[model samples]
Target: MAEIALCFAAMALRGFGGVLGHSYDILVVRRQWLSEREFAEVYGIGQLVPGGNIINVAAILGDRWAGLAGATAALAGLTLPSTLIAVALLGLASKLAGEPHVASAERAVVAAAAGIVLASGLRTLRTIREAGRPRLVAARAAIAAFACAIACVPFVGLPIAVIVATPLAFLLERRAAR
Candidate 1:
């Protein structure tokens, strides 16, 4: 119970704009608490549900660890502090909205967040490379990247890209399996 609370509190402390992606990956993959596949499953389910992804993750982990009681504890640990901090920051931002220095600091934070995203991408790529299934890994990476890029364009259907790429990824994996 204490450990679960500590884990969530630590996650809450590190929570910043868009930092959850890197944090989730690190906790699920690097820490060996969950497999990449398990993380993907939980994340996918979270996306399908109503709440925020990180909060959903907390709930899922809590449920896994200690059932309903655990889930409630994890939710409280993960959300309360961050929610309070965010509300305080929002109040401060309203006061500082017209300040040039505040605006500059906000821009700096945005840039830092972008850097973190890039670093997380690189780390994921490194993990794929180290998985010892180079051919399948490379093929999936290429397909996923192409699909993602195509999905970004207006009027291009994201589902189409997934439909086209899934078979290619499967074929590549099958070949690698042999």
Candidate 2:
């Protein structure tokens, strides 16, 4: 449990704009906690479920390793450090809210965050698509939908993109199947 906490804590600390990519490095490459395909599957499920993907992953992983106790530890470790930092940053941002430089910085941060999200989505999609399950035709539709969602987020934002992409993905998949 301690190890799980520490590992997740460390991952959280190192993760900034692109936590999922960092997770792939740590969990799949460095820690060897999961194989490539296993990480892909876990990440896919994490994304599909509600709330933050990484938090979901930590819970799933922690539970896998040590049941409920481990899940608690992982959640604590994953959230605590980031929460503290976000609070501190919030305080500073509030103090500087009216400054011209602050607004520019905030804009820059938003742009960067959007880029990170798009890149992370594409990376995860590629990983899932490469898993070599040709029989799962439905997976192709999902991949197309996810790709469209990623593409649209930078333009239309998430909710709208998902709303528009879902039906389009199914249509494309159906056409391809014919």
Candidate 3:
């Protein structure tokens, strides 16, 4: 239980704008708690759920390990550290909001976060290919490209884009599986 809490707590600290990449590194690569396919499946379910994806994953993983208690520990570990830091950073950001350096730092962080997400995607793609689903790469990439394009459209928004893209992705997957 303590280990689960510590694992998520560590992930929380490294989390910037997103933590999916960090989650993969810690849970899959470093800790070896989950395999690539397991992480991908967990992450997919996490995205489908209503709340934050990583948070959902933490809860699920915790529950899988130690039932309700594990879930509680994981959630606390994943949220508490980051929440406290965010509060402190919020106060600081308010104070430094007008500073040029802060603006530059924000841009840099955004870029880094984007890079992390892209890398995570690539890693997942590789995992899919290696999992004996080699034909999925082109289909998955096309779906990703379509989702990205849809997300960039004015007022289209991520939710709508996801809604639009999901069935298409499912269809493509089904076809590819055949």
lDDT of 2 by residue, 1-178 (tens): 8999999998999986647888899899999999999999998889888799999999999999999999999999999988999999999889999999989999998998889778876686665445345655466646567657576557657666666676775675576557
lDDT of each residue in 1-178, candidate 1, tens digit only: 7677667777777765654665565577666678888888888887657668778888998899899988988888888877888899899898998999999999998999889867865775665455446666767678768876777667766667767877886787677767
Backbone clashes, each candidate: 0, 0, 0
Top TM-score hit? 2
How do the predictions measure up, each by TM-score?
0.61, 0.66, 0.64
Residue pair clashes in candidate 2: none
For model 2 the TM-score comes to 0.66
lDDT of residue 171 for candidate 3: 87
Off by over 4 Å in 1: 1-7, 14-57, 131-138, 154-171
By lDDT, who's the top model here? 3
Sort the predicted structures by TM-score, highest score first. 2, 3, 1
- Report model 1's TM-score to 2 decimal places: 0.61
Q: Model 2's lDDT to the true fold?
A: 0.82
